[model samples]
Target: MTALPYRPCAGIMLIDRHGRAFVGQRMDSTLEAWQMPQGGIDPGEDPLAAATRELWEETGVASDMVEFIAAPDQEFFYDLPEDLIGKVWKGKWRGQRQRWFLFRFLGEDGDIDIATPHPEFRSWRWIDPAELPRLVVPFKRALYEAVLAAFRPYLNTQIGIEAVSQSDRPR
Candidate 1:
């Protein structure tokens, strides 16, 4: 049998003011599954643009609410499990080859509206970047880890931490 090709995709890491990453509970999963925004890239679409579009479609976050931060030098890839190889995506693809982005969320929590025209998530929340791998499906754990690694430098910066006035700090 011929090997199946990978689907071109884009992934998003939406980081809020508190330095937490957005995670959504997939409407299609029965397990305690959660993941960041991701989707197949449209034909002839730019990967970065596709990432912005996916972020909005899946999370209801508008472009104004996000600022693009950075992406890894290399895209990440993952394979579907044997049982799912021929069931998902019409079996046209074996897995996804994803280009990921780190976007800083500039809007308030109320800005998020998951009831998109085609909602992929049932619910969502912000999570620590370190916990992303544990939150996703086992098959995609490595992918999540790589994403975290790629964004590690940004995660450590003061980008997501809430600031306090000097008076508010413990003296």
Candidate 2:
């Protein structure tokens, strides 16, 4: 059935100093696909806050270690595959409606620790932003493409670096 509502979620696209996006291989999957930090938003919680928390919970990256870069004008949505629609998320959601936020990592790579209290990733690494769709699971490729397109102007560019650096400066 196509009537199930998508879960409201937030996603974090953290960019390292080299301007690559962070991706993680799922601990529960046998496939080679990877994904960024994302999770359902708690009731009454702001999406930005949810994104921040998800990033920390999944990657051990605190809010202050990164600078907010930019967010697209829209949210991205994707549906689960036909065979697994009822096998995930307690079979409650059709998929996710994700609000993605871009953040520039200000700390050293050592600051990142995927071995969190409750880890979801088996491994993690930074990759070129344009390759996100190819690295993600098939179901979420389109969503990743849209995210990459929306943030293309800022990713891996000197303008984006300057902008993020400027924002971190004292008034």
Top candidate on TM-score is 2
Clashing pairs in 2: none
Evaluated at residue 122, the lDDT of candidate 2 is: 94
71-153, model 2: which lDDT tens digit per residue? Answer: 76587999999888889988898989999888988888889899999999999998888889999999899999999888887
Name model 2 segments beyond 4 Å from true. 157-171
Model 2 poorest ten-residue lDDT run: 162-171
| Cα lDDT, model 1, residue 125 | 96
List model 1 lDDT by residue over 34-112, tens digit each: 9999999999998888888998899889888887777776889999988987788988998899989888899999999
Note the residue pairs that clash in candidate 1.
Answer: 17-160, 18-160, 19-160
Measured against the true structure, the TM-scores of the candidates, in listed sequence, are 0.91, 0.92
